[model samples]
Target: MADPQPARRPGGRTARVRGAVHRAVTELLAEKAPDEVTIAAVAERSGVHQATLYRRWGTMTGLVEDVVAEVLNRGSPIPDTGSLRGDLSAFAVNAAAGLASPMGTVYLRAIALGVGPAEGAPDGGHPGFDARAQQLQEMLDRATARGEPVPTLPDLLEVVLAPMYFRALLLKQPPDEEQAHAVVDRLLALTRG
Candidate 1:
């Protein structure tokens, strides 16, 4: 008879280590600048070995990218309000609120500074951007499935996301709910034309 395969543990040691490391990174980012947070500091704070961090994330940028992705994903889930306008409006408001937070500001700065190339980018593109793009695409796909008119990704980026990001990251003024809704309305209007 063939040997039985070992059972996988979802919340195993590997998961614990990653959780500790991620928590450490987030705390450090809250207290200090991205450049000030280092592998040694994270190792000491997380109680995980420096070698383990290096083995898992490759570099500070890699670690930051993972943290940013996690933060965004957890903070702003895709809404399903049964309409494209409702979804985008909720998404925009949530996104704006996240960006307006202290941690969000830190994340925006890290992204703006171009931490490093993403894991699979051949030309050194930002992974955070890629993650957001995937999120937007998912939302668009849902809208399309519902027989709703959807703007192209570029149009969404330019009309909806760009303005919010510009106001938050560049202008240091995150949009309020009214402004966010206006941005969504503007994007929806584009689809009508």
Candidate 2:
């Protein structure tokens, strides 16, 4: 029998290329609107061939989806600060900071505008939103495990995340720490009832 191929390591050349491409996309999104970020621009910025980009990502939407997923996963890691309040507060603050950033604003608007998959996501949802929902659920599960009174994911989303997103994406006002804390407090108050 022919020798089986070795499993591909994550830190290989492929990962380097992906990292470069993602960084290039991020920088471009930070500097300009999502509509202005083209595959050719990414190719030039990343020093990777346009053919390579087309072969790997298939489309600009695909590339944006990948970048959004990577950013959402890496940017705001779920906190484990022992108490629900601390965790929620930390998460809110981090989320506020991220949403306030130039790249964050672009990506969040992209996600909100459904710039990713057309359909067929797990639970018939956008992958970026699903990933964030999963992260929120993980935090809620941790709080439950600690015997803490936890609010529903919808409640958290409505009371905390929605306002931040609205402010950043619609109002053109990224939330500051004080606003984040106030939102957290509002969520906590609702959960206390």
Candidate 3:
């Protein structure tokens, strides 16, 4: 078996402290607002010391931002399938698969708290929720490689992601192979109409 990502350590103690704070605080914010966040709580959840949380984060806002980075960075990259339909099916399955677990549902709900109905990213900027969106968007890029123009990314989201997530998050349904493949089927039907 090969490691999908090679583990690399930062050379500095400062970087280590930063990483610890980021992980700890993000875990804390998984269910609560930054104001409700406490150093003791972060320490208890992350196994880091209260001193470290205080020294590194300096303030609640700092802690919150660092944790936000960690949360946004936690997602794995989406797969590429060389066609909008195939790639979206893969993306839908991948995204929905995670939403099936309790931890996954909790994380999804936590993120939803921070995200309002908006365009672009969860952060309200165009950078768009770290690389997960880009990885997902790559599925559309695959269409161009096959001589078809990739549709608008949001439109792609509506057709592929909307249903998958809605079912998984709101209905507590796990996406099966049939349901995953239906994303592709639905998109194809819509496009042909």
Candidate 3's TM-score reads 0.64
Candidate 2 wrong stretches, greater than 4 Å: 1-7, 116-124, 128-131
Residues 1-193 of candidate 2: C-alpha lDDT, one tens digit per residue: 0001225477888878888988898888778776788999999999999999898877777677777766676765787999989989999999898888777776775575453346235455444567778889999999999898899999999999889988886788888899899999999998889
lDDT by residue (tens digit), candidate 3, 1-193: 0111235455566566666656665556656664566777777776777886677556454455444445446656666655666667766676666666544554555455445443223444322254556765666666767877456677666877677777776787766667778876877777656
Show model 3 residue runs off by greater than 4 Å. Answer: 1-11, 22-39, 47-74, 116-130
Best by lDDT: 2
Model 3 has an lDDT value of: 0.60
lDDT of each: 0.77, 0.80, 0.60
Positional deviation of 49 in candidate 2, in angstroms? Answer: 1.6
Best by TM-score: 2
Q: Tell me each candidate's TM-score.
A: 0.80, 0.84, 0.64
RMSD values, in order shown: 5.5, 4.7, 6.4
